[model samples]
Target: MQTIRLTDLIAAIEGTAGPMGDASRSRRPGADPDSAAEHPTASGAVAKESLTRTGDRAAKEGRAPSGQGESLPVPRIVTDSRQVQPGDVFWALRGERLDGHAFVGDAVQRGARVCVVDADRVTECKGPAAEAVLIQVDDTLTALQRLAGWYRCRLATSVIAVTGSVGKTTTREMIQAVLSAGRRVIRSPRNYNNQIGVPLSLLAIEPHHELAVLELAASHSGEIAALAELVRPHVGVVTGVAPDGDSSNPSISGDGRYVAFESSDRK
Candidate 1:
């Protein structure tokens, strides 16, 4: 018996293409090559793996992707105005004492399409970005979590969940690093290891991703468990453990780290 290498198997399974190096073939013996990719980013987003079904690609499905209405502009969710993008849903989270509700108007003026405000004093900062959807949640963080939960329910990729006082980012990066080095892997970027961070990270997961690595972090008790429930990792990896008293789970390098994950029952 003989065993074919997995790489060969994968190539056979998905098919492959070679570079079309013949300039004459492309130019049709006379066409100009300068017409290629003039305004590269004009309307082109990074080409992710295509997830559109053949039928969906050919014809309109029963329902539109973003509902019956026209596709809405991208919302700039800002924890701070500095990170604001045009047409974003500004998530006005509260700080020590300063509230996001204060800058709601300013964010709208700056090009935010909508505002998701914490419901303590949003009334004071109404108007402007007036066309924005003013959703009222008891806590902004909770609302963010709920939105992410909803998003997870809609995904099909096997989610890789990560959480630790430290090294969560490093581990998550490692997993994504290994997966994406050769494949179109979609994973969270950096230490977005918090409640809000996870959801924001999810937004980065385009339909094109075949895999995703989600980073979760918490300082207080039950933080890991709660985030775990939200992500619903079929496989879990805990990078390390910190002192029980102090709420710091630092990430480190090397395979020599304390990690816990679920496994299938023994045969």
Candidate 2:
């Protein structure tokens, strides 16, 4: 249904909000803004239509509506071949146990509109799959993170990031329900609090949302920092610190507006 423009995504990943960025209300501009928009690049090329969705969104829904040429809406993103649908972007992730690269052909066969691959594995996408738009990145994981960050920066909605060893999810849910009681709110779905999961959550944000409450979970070093860099929350919340809780506190944008929580157990 809704899609972010390819040009805007390029500018965001590059850390430069370009002309298209100024046009779209969302950080990741949608194709509907300028269907005729064209961007010729070697690494990340845009076809007649320039739009993409987060993997979570695509998997949760069925095939998207189709349009003609430049008027075409951006496709949804899917990491699994089984979820691939017409006008979908398949992110080829390389995990320790399995490599997504192996399924590029399968994705294309299933009607994927685009595919993200590593710089070294471009050759893996061949035959009919080559017809789909190819987005090459130094690393798919990093690309996914940057794209999420790009989308996060474009939002005018207030962002509330919560992190802790325990009760992070519970705290987020409570905050979301209370805020949503009055405002149009969007919060992280389920326990999506990791590198890949977080990005998908961010990408799920739509234009009408007024508030965003994202829950952050960190088990290793730099995880919180990475989330902070991407979200740059206006309000940072830290629940009670448990033994397995995230020691790294959420960082704010330092725009002179922020909120924090202590033990919440006032004696």
Candidate 3:
């Protein structure tokens, strides 16, 4: 099997550098740079892994880093407060060393347009800049997943899923190469072919993508179903499975695949 890796230039960023807001800049011509920096949200975001949006898959895999001339707008999905910049949006994810909710005041002072917070914390927070919009979510992680799923459904192009006992990655690569001839195909990074990887792929999908081909692997039962629930691939092809009940997608595809409870353990 060929080793699949993504180039740093194309890997999505989960956090950002803090830029001082105008208010802080006005405090002094050359105020303390550290003082100017503020956290991204009331709480830092979920984790860097949880900062991705639903349909913005990263491209440029396998390509060397190129110097981009202009600054790209910071996506609002960062999971850390320290990554917050004045103009960026912040998602307050509940996690270690930070609760996105705990940093709302800093985010507002630093210039966050909106803050996503746990609905449970809505009544518990207060700050001077009461103007910041607080969007309520039942569970940040689940909400993020649902948002990605919704965004995935908006595409009008072809969506393909590939599964196999052997050479799943190689087959996916071949399929990607063949489809890249004329279409703007968005293949999952490496083998982001499972439950978590599928959603990550969907988060990276762009508005202009012409195709999405996900490479799937299953070492345990029900794993495909977990991936299937999130990816909902219109087309899927499984490679092979072990007879010791170590692999199958019975519930995922029924037609051929087996689903099991231990499917989400891929690292």
Best by lDDT: 2
Q: How do all the candidates rank in terms of TM-score, highest first?
A: 2, 1, 3
Question: How many Å off is the CA of 32 in candidate 1?
Answer: 57
Q: Candidate 1 vs candidate 2: which has greater TM-score?
A: 2
Model 2 C-alpha lDDT per residue in residues 96-182, reported as the tens digit of each score = 545678888888888877777776777656443555655556666566666676676666777788886568899999999999889
- For candidate 3, give the lDDT of residue 145: 44
lDDT of 3 at 241: 57
Per-residue lDDT of model 1, residues 147-198, tens digit only = 5454555556677887655677878888888988877777765556555566
Cα error, candidate 1, residue 92 (Å): 0.8
Number of the predicted model whose TM-score against the real structure is largest: 2
TM-score of each: 0.62, 0.69, 0.50
State each candidate's clash count. 12, 4, 34
Q: Which stretches of candidate 3 lie over 4 Å from their true place?
A: 1-112, 121-132, 164-167, 190-196, 216-223, 245-267
